[model samples]
Target: MVKESKLLPRPEFQRRLVWSRDDKNHFLDSVLRGYPFPEIYFADGDVNLETGEGTQLLVDGLQRVSTLIQYFDGDDNLKLTSAPTYRALNEDEKKAFLQYDVAVRDLGGISKEEIIEVFKRLNATKYSLLDIEINNAVYAGALKTFCEQIAEKDFFRAHNIFNASDYKRMGDLRYVLSLVGTMVQGYFNRDDAFENLLDRYNDEFPMHAEISGRLQNIFDFIEECGFDPKTRAWKKADLFTLLIELDQVLHIRNERLQPSKVLEELTSFYDGVDSSGVNQGSVSSIYYKAALQASNDKINRVRRGAIIGGILLELSESEIREKLRVEGLA
Candidate 1:
């Protein structure tokens, strides 16, 4: 169809091919390994009445089709890492490659406006996709990929930072994006700044090396603290606050935190929250409440940060007793 010009891969409304070389390679790998990909969509285009031949406008899957054409032609630009080139395959393998099944849908006799609407709906939110999931389609660039790599880090897996649902819905990516985004440009309410950060660094993430090292050190420090996994500190919300607080003290303030002190202090504070807030100071109680409410709001985030930051400070024996227990130490 491509050779005969009966299939128009890119209509005036189709998005330009945006898949990277790695993405193309991975797609080809799946094809070579005999894995099925999603179906393509097409709509009717201009028909030549005399010849009774009509072109079909490619409504979707432009990237996939383009990559396949490139592979068939052995285009110099289409490099394969794991998947063998089409020319390298023997007769039988080459026949299988040419005969690979691509499920396609034909939206026949649709108006241009309908085609446009279909394109819009195809790309835009459908099935209540999360903002992060939508962003995954829009931005396959550096910042987004960076967050994805961080989400897969062994540290998060070891600490069980993300649950199964998180992995399924890209919540893990969202969490890492929130953390990295906050580290670069202080706290913002929920994920308000994620799109801005993603757009700004789409082509290149300037702070990748520096931020990677900073986060690694922070993760190592947290591991050294040896806080019990069953404690509140390991809860998603509390862990986020703790990491942000540590980032401030260690990186922003250029001060070192005592691991033993952090473990002892945070464990006691979390324990107080678990024990019905009894004997805990007003500040600790406030932090606990903030964590329970709209914890992602900027106001609550700031409040939590202030309290956690204060906890990291070196205090006198009197201050310690006064801060942790308003009713006096037991």
Candidate 2:
């Protein structure tokens, strides 16, 4: 109830709601089963010494409290393991639920930075969201907004470039940002390259919008070229490489691109790779893993971009050829 009060504002710093339905259901199940929850931390505020009224800001556990309030109010359609909803509970169930004690540690007059630190320390999990989601929360400016536009586009849905969870977790948005970031910076580093670009999004907010526009144009070109859906070109490293290279050179091309031809060339390139000493069975996974790893390396990024450029050059695509020459690339 205090959460709804404007006197205590906790929305100043909070993680994105990336919890899955299953995760919420599991938590709700545990609550209904009388299991104890972890201590939720709060920042203490000033109080009226006489009336004993004061405001407290939540430092952590927003999701948990949100889920509880949502379930009790029968607002969200959460699948319950034990009962329908808090409102559906019997008198005894209601009494037990109300009587259930939740642990809380309130720090008086905590600084905002200290509260954010506490919040981060508490949510250290595989779903800890130290990447795009967290960054989006802190920098809820143009970058986050542009990412939303890209993720919500019909092109991504129709092409299956990214899914619902990818959107929720900001994976798809990060992928596009990574490609654009790599191309714009003229290099790809195995470490910190992506991180540095994301941090710059706060200041380079307008650039993200321009990049989004170019990206949409590139996707349109890919579809116009007739890329085969069976090639799964819409996913992973191949798509990343293709998009980066196309954005660099295709804008100035006088002729249209042939997606089927590009797919065929790419497929042939993969099929003809030599794995002389690689073991059979699951060992092929090593090569697959290596290809993915190369997707981030400086040398490999240049190589992959050059491969696409070479193909276009062969077809008298002078724009790609000129780009390679000017960039001092093969």
Candidate 1 per-residue C-alpha lDDT over 1-330 given as tens digits, one digit per residue, 9 for 90 to 100: 988899998775564355777989999998988899999999999999999989999988888999999999999998788788888899998888889999999999999878866766786643344677556646679998888888888989998888766776678889999999989989899978877888999999999999998899989999999999899888888888888889889998999888998999888877866765624656666677778889988777876766677788755535644554553321
Return the number of clashes found in candidate 2.
1
The TM-score measured for candidate 1 stands at: 0.62
Candidate 2 positional error at 110, Å: 3.6
Q: Pick the candidate with the highest TM-score.
A: 2
Query: Candidate 2 residues 73-127, lDDT tens each?
Result: 7875666655568877899998888788889887778876677677776778766
- Itemize residue pairs with steric clashes in candidate 1: none
Query: What shift in Å separates residue 172 of candidate 2 from its native position after superposition?
Result: 2.3
Off by over 4 Å in 1: 1-127, 277-281, 315-330
